[model samples]
Target chain A: MTRPGFTGSALDRADPIRQDPAALAAARADAGARLLRMDGIDPVVGPDGLLDWGGLDEAPPGAFLALLGLIGGSPRFVALSGIPGGAQRSPLMMELLDAWPPEEAATYAAARSLIDWHARHPFCARCGAETAPIRGGWARSCPRCRTEHFPRVDPVVIMLAEHRGRVLVGRQASWKPGRYSALAGFVEPGESVEEAVARELHEEAGILATDIRYLASQPWPFPSQLMIACVARTANDALTIDRHELDHAMWVDRAGVEAALAKLPGAPFDPPPAYAIAHSLFRMWLDG
Target chain B: MTRPGFTGSALDRADPIRQDPAALAAARADAGARLLRMDGIDPVVGPDGLLDWGGLDEAPPGAFLALLGLIGGSPRFVALSGIPGGAQRSPLMMELLDAWPPEEAATYAAARSLIDWHARHPFCARCGAETAPIRGGWARSCPRCRTEHFPRVDPVVIMLAEHRGRVLVGRQASWKPGRYSALAGFVEPGESVEEAVARELHEEAGILATDIRYLASQPWPFPSQLMIACVARTANDALTIDRHELDHAMWVDRAGVEAALAKLPGAPFDPPPAYAIAHSLFRMWLDG
Candidate 1:
């Protein structure tokens, strides 16, 4: 099994109900239906430090309710942008990554991504028509053009480049002090994951890589991205960083990575947290 | 490497130039800028059966030109709904999959997907405002909402299930006679790829799977999808077909699959074509 924040859920996405308007309405009225509310991207949490599943009566009007799935014979819905004012909300998504169990974290990730999509897509891109939530908020349908829009999940290639017993890591300009992670970028329209890996490595650090191998995938819901993790073997170690894309990049030996992972006193940089695929990739390389 | 139709292109997207309107206008007049026109979903082909890269001078007015990349120091663009009246056009995307080389075929796939996206998304989904093509057709921006919309690629799980030396294959209700392929479905909003594979297997064929492994992936541009190919081992082989989803599902031994692959006289059913990831999975299982 992958580490937490990757993807694992107990909810059975009863998708057939999504197409049935009457069934969806009935689900909303069902007493067993639980509501997971979101205030913008931040999830509303109860005093117990878990997702506050509130009653449907407490949800605000015009809130978009996305049917997450049937968990234990109860239909669960995630309400976006409809929290009645004065509800306690948690911090941003990254901060709440580990606050819940794996299944609950995955649920929050799904709800957050869906909510983000709904927030961004309110009009029909097909004909400048207003699109209303349909199919239990799993889809948006344009009233004029009749175009149905589903949620989007962008594929990204995040790779760990190993060369001569050292792994290449880069720090983005926006990251905190002394923080570095694997080189990553969005997969372009026409490229394979392998091609994306090679292109990102060369573009970000001026390193040419071969022997690319896919590791695993994690669903990153900082707005619906599928992080396809990979490892590549590089022949050259010299670095030419693109200042526009990265602040700095360098090769770190196993000991250095271990120190960073352990947060030793003299570690050169802080590695990504255990919730990230970057951390998994680093650990895999160090252990292998 | 993965099977053909997965991905192939060495073109540097040079995406930064996409934001520069001056660069885009210059490319439009560069004489070397070749345009691939699409009439709806079909590419305008020349008499010689190649993608007709016509001169920009002949393009129709108000054509949506999607910048593919800088191929060999020249820009390549795909124009949607702008084929000249006299040019010969291919039937549709699926029919022309094998007409071009692997790289060119991959390019056509990308172009077709982008064109489809442009055709469907003409308005902003956020505020019901008209959206204009921006970033060289890679994205659309709403004039009122200031929201940017990018191309979407949906993820699907296509898996081959094997148990006791017999592989499971199913035929969808809509397929032609004697055609059976791998069990496949879209990955739901919250589940991992592993969960998708298992869920699809059980939902479609009443099989419980274990030992799920990712084999390969293909960019299936039948309206923009990323086909994630996998293989799983089943603990029990009892077959219970869901009539709504599949007409029939059965386990085939190695000899049966080999016979079908070879097109033997007494073969029970026909497998998927070589261009499909289903064919690759079957080939891998048989060869291994």
Candidate 2:
């Protein structure tokens, strides 16, 4: 299977040094230290189709800085940034993903999640006290209550529910016309990945899931999400679709899936983009 | 593989009803509405080794209440309760797991997670506004900024790194004497499960991971964590233990693991309790 987009980052997170103030200070002072350049949370891609970087002096004064990682023993830093954007994937992000190396995309993703988490959560949830970066910006500590906060990666389950050699898929009304993808929803607290898959299937399409299996995972930086991909079997073909959540829901056979995946004329629907884990699911399904 | 602890719940989450206020009111008013009885965050076990329950009238007035699920056409509800206890697993919880039906334990785990989240996050992190439960207590909405908050399920990677005939394991200083378990850490934002497994193994034991494979997942509701169990291979047996996080690290062969599992008198170390996902990871490792 192809390595999913926004993965396979080569940077060593160097967590051991994150705890040592002296080490972190030395890293910042190193002549080779590079700071990732960004436009808010968006990546600033270089001519070489990788993340743009500059000396540590380029960081905005007083902005929080987090160690992205180390490459060739040079410290990589990103200034923490956030404006609390809506949970909508943008066309610019798609373009950025296509224009950068997968590893650089992943490195940017890590830095973005950490920085945004710090910016959006200036106060602690436990005691409503102001927070400051700690652990080299991997975590935050509340000064008043001393409550610690870690950057959260919300888990979302995207899956193909199959029955009788057909796969279940759905598309929202607002999406590009003729674009359909596997159904997905956030894995709520207190639910396992399998349970989330089953719950989401049942709630959105009235499909009872069985034999839920983990396929692969991808880190999506639309404000930091971990997409857990899976495939499951459905007991029957019946779907009680929730129209409010989906514009249409269908079970497409392998031939229809192939046509869609190939982007042929008169295809049932357009496949999800290559960067989406759902596309990988369809590819795996085709192979099976 | 055996079902991990805190899974296989039987209740219908009834998400559709969660969105309708009239339906929520109807559920609460139903004569069959059942309130889970709890002594603080701990379970109140019935004589039949199931969760004890009472009528809706037992709920604390004006306390946040969540619809847990529907069981046999009856409404099951849990009052959102929290006192922010330290993250310590009590001995009583172990006894409850040993005594109760697994399904009931799962149900209780779900309720505890939801209720505790509501209690801990009364103030919104986005704007520090006082938040109120919406969507049948499944989500909190900040009145000031209208930013919605869903309960977070922190994903943690627990893995065994094998080299030659032995598997890597570690023990925390505060654990019961001679008790060892898989090295685990929270999956930070912007990393896949595979990345987390590799990062955690390297940080905790200096073992570089390869062929990281997901075994299974378990929802642990001690403040709501999703334990993703995995196994990976290490290239060599060379050891570099970080004493700050782990008191001791070792590579034990199948014989050593078997003896530990059996509670033999001369076991190298005590196996983690049956309720921990680490225990299930070891069991799966042995089967291979």
Candidate 3:
């Protein structure tokens, strides 16, 4: 089973948008600081092996560093978390935007999420006009169309399907080899999270679930998603991966997963990082 | 036992100052258009008891009606849902900003709630300077001190507490006489809805509840609130009204409530209007 809060390296990428309006203002007003559009920057690793946010007044300009939010009463900035010019680069980045206190991660998550949204939705969708950041950068207003735009977050359902003392997980070929995790997918336009969980499992792995119950929720800002976690019972289990979406699908016994977790890379299955909700589901099941 | 969606009028004063760009554009471009600021107009109730949006041809030289969202397929315009100078006169007129359908009311509610927020929060709380609408009306940005303001939705836990076959209901002095319904209260900052339900029950009725289960949720915009519906088991049946918040509290057996539902305004306990969630909660319990 997955463990809660185990962060994976696969999901973290550096976002390139200047999210902190306050910092943007500071940078803009400072005679020594330079202002550059996101497109003008090149993809290159700095001396630190991380996407650089440039140096102090005396240092060289690296990746553009912009302050985003404050976590635990301290300023937090987004880093280019991925390798520069790497083939597997994902545009989205997941950083611990908040300070290390951790108990109040939800607050930092909310702040980081809105900042990320601002970076992406810079124009009015209805009129396709350039929008200006207003309301302290929490929203944007278009001069041409006057349309106001807010950040958007999609909801996805992640569930642990349990029966016969075992929980089910599936693997996508895109993930690291032998890494299997809970069944998850986005909630559709007209469906509830509960319905989405059942539908996703049915479509991806041919599993029918019943007695669904909600457990917890996590703010997953990998391009703005809210993961609704749930627990369900499997009425039937058969292997069927929609080859178009997944490379393989199966029902692994809890003991089998335990063995895999113990064996590391040698096993045919590994759970997602502990920070993910999937890890939490697996941990809850194993603890029980 | 508390029913589904019943409580007196929700707190309805909002603090947004931003306008929807698209709606503003449509208003400006309409053939018979005029625009008037909230401070410039004197609202009048017609003989028919409805505030009229003067026809396109008759609209004063620069007058345009403000529209919010779509109802059904047509745009729903804001023309005053209440009368001027009435005892229940709205402190603020509800603006029709978009044509949001009822099926997507939750999403529409979010949009409406935030847009309405911008309409109200025009000044920085920290510094009294005028703020501009930002992030498409999701927030307000202060130019003087650079502060961002976000829309706030108060979370309330509405619960159905069951004791054997009977359900609990309560009445508030401000409500219509004989109008009794579910128990609910606002969830404070830093508290979960589950904890809110448990605390509200104990405070208002002197009862303890266990077995809390989430049932459903609704977006109520009397002034932007997210109502979380839940079911709980009563640990004790003693009745005590915390008059600080409610007028009366009591436990009515299922049969009595069923009988009361059939005769509104006649019995000591009255069911809420059919459109309310409280009525649905009562129905669910009765059917169960």
| Best-fitting candidate, scored by TM-score | 2
The most accurate candidate by DockQ is: 2
Clashes of 2: 0
True contacts kept of 2: 0.63
TM-score, cand. 2 vs. native: 0.97
Model 2 local distance difference test score: 0.85
Please give, for every candidate in the order listed, the TM-score of chain B alone compared with the true chain B: 0.90, 0.96, 0.66
Q: Per-residue lDDT for A145-194 in model 2, tens only? A: 78788887888999999999999989999999888999999887777899
Scored by lDDT, model 3 comes in at 0.53
Interface RMSD of 1: 1.8
Q: Order of all candidates by lDDT, from best down to worst?
A: 2, 1, 3
Once superposed on the true structure, which residue ranges of model 2 sit more than 4 Å away at CA? A81-90, B85-87
Segments in model 1 whose C-alpha atoms lie over 4 Å from true places = A1-6, A21-26, A37-40, A62-64, A82-93, B37-40, B46-49, B62-64, B82-95
- Which lDDT tens digits does candidate 3 get at residues A1-288? 332331211211111113436555554344443211121122223354333333234222452343433323233333222222212223332333211222333333443454455544444544445566554344567797566654555556799888787777777878887788888876532234455577777777778888878775555645355566788898987666766567876667777767665665556577775557776776676777
Candidate 3 residue-wise lDDT at A32? 47
Total clashes for model 3: 62
Which 10 consecutive positions of candidate 3 chain B have the poorest summed lDDT?
B8-17
Highest lDDT, which number?
A: 2
